[model samples]
Target: MTRTTGYEPLFTLKPVAPEIWVVDGPILKFYGLPFPTRMVVVRLTDGGLWLHSPIQMDDGLLQALAALGPVQHLMAPNWIHYAFVPDWQRAFPKAQTWAAPGVQERAGSRGLALRVDHQITDHAPDAWAGQVDQLVVPGSPVHREAVFFHRASKTLILTDLIENFEAANLPVWLIPLAWAAGTLDPDGKAPIDMRQTFRKGREAARGAIETMLSWEPERLIMAHGRWYETGAMAELNRAFRWVLR
Candidate 1:
């Protein structure tokens, strides 16, 4: 049930670049399925912190993040990824909360009075425009995930788009399920269900991939499982081949 985060020293920042870091958090069970959590922290050019899909936070984690910089933006990268945004907002009341499409509706469905300050588009907002780029992958109504690429670090950030669950980290029973869902490491891609959403018109997904490749990413960060430390372009192509084809 544990090890979903996969990285060590849970809830602590792991430096990826001078301006970028990752925090692997505790496992969260979704509909009886145990899923590890992760978040991307980016320090904008002006020194404000942009949190992408923030994980659960505690006092120690808050103090550690405070040391990084001012938490200016709390981003809900996708609809379901906003669970802990309220916690972060409560801590840093001044931080602006941005959400991807459908997040507000998802929150309402769950009876959560989530505050969404702005809706993300395919382009980065002026807040971090030159620092980060965003793309809204089309062809799916339900899985309208807006992905990001950090220009300074050449790090591409994805949510459930590509889940690479390591066998060693997954539970004994989850190993097969991960494999069946095409989320196992070394050959991971978008889950079968998500891929299906783009089946009707994958050209949009392929276009998104083309744009991502144009960024010449050096590494990749995913919310679940192991993220790539290098060869991000190849992995990006390999992981989204189902939709690209």
Candidate 2:
């Protein structure tokens, strides 16, 4: 079965901080392996929402999000993470969609009808510039993710960089696969193959890691599995030690 177990009570917003919430969504198969999905919701200072790596849109989710604020921005944090963005853009028709470097090309290569309203850069855009800080992490061409840090919440938002899948939640056979991929909980970093892609881009990857570490984030959120609720400095150092050190 390609359907994997996920955090239950999916597609509902759960509080993360004062203005930050997370929506845990259904499992999606990646190359025949099921992986749980998650997305971050930040109600900006203007009451508009900035969704990071948006999950599936359902009626209840749409209505609940509408109550929060207008979905102003739909984020494609990384190339591989933009699958559901097309649906989200249809739901929030006026919402501006942002992509990381190479995400547009990646989407096109996949034959996904996606739109790119803006591309993330070293500086955050006027829409979310003051409230949130963004950086396009340089490393693997396919994994060049636009990572965000919400200054108000001191939360670091990431997608695919660190996937911490719990052993018990996965199928017994998948546990070994997780270990081989280096996604086992408590030690999750990028998957083993993704790490190889950073070899040629080591300096660039280190620069990105250094920037993320400099943020001194308190909470680290990732799309897959359990995220670090505290001690982000240590976690950042530990997770990126392979490339950074």
Per TM-score, the best of the predicted structures is: 1
Candidate 1 Cα RMSD (Å): 1.3
- List the global CA lDDT of all models: 0.88, 0.88
TM-score of 1: 0.97
TM-scores of the models, in the order given: 0.97, 0.96
lDDT of 2 by residue, 114-161 (tens): 999998887998888888998887867657888899999899999988
For candidate 1, lDDT tens digit of each residue in 145-172? 8899998889999999999999998879
Residue 194 lDDT (model 2): 89
How many clashes in each structure? 0, 0
- Model 1 off-target regions past 4 Å? 1-5
* Regions of model 2 farther than 4 Å from truth: 1-6
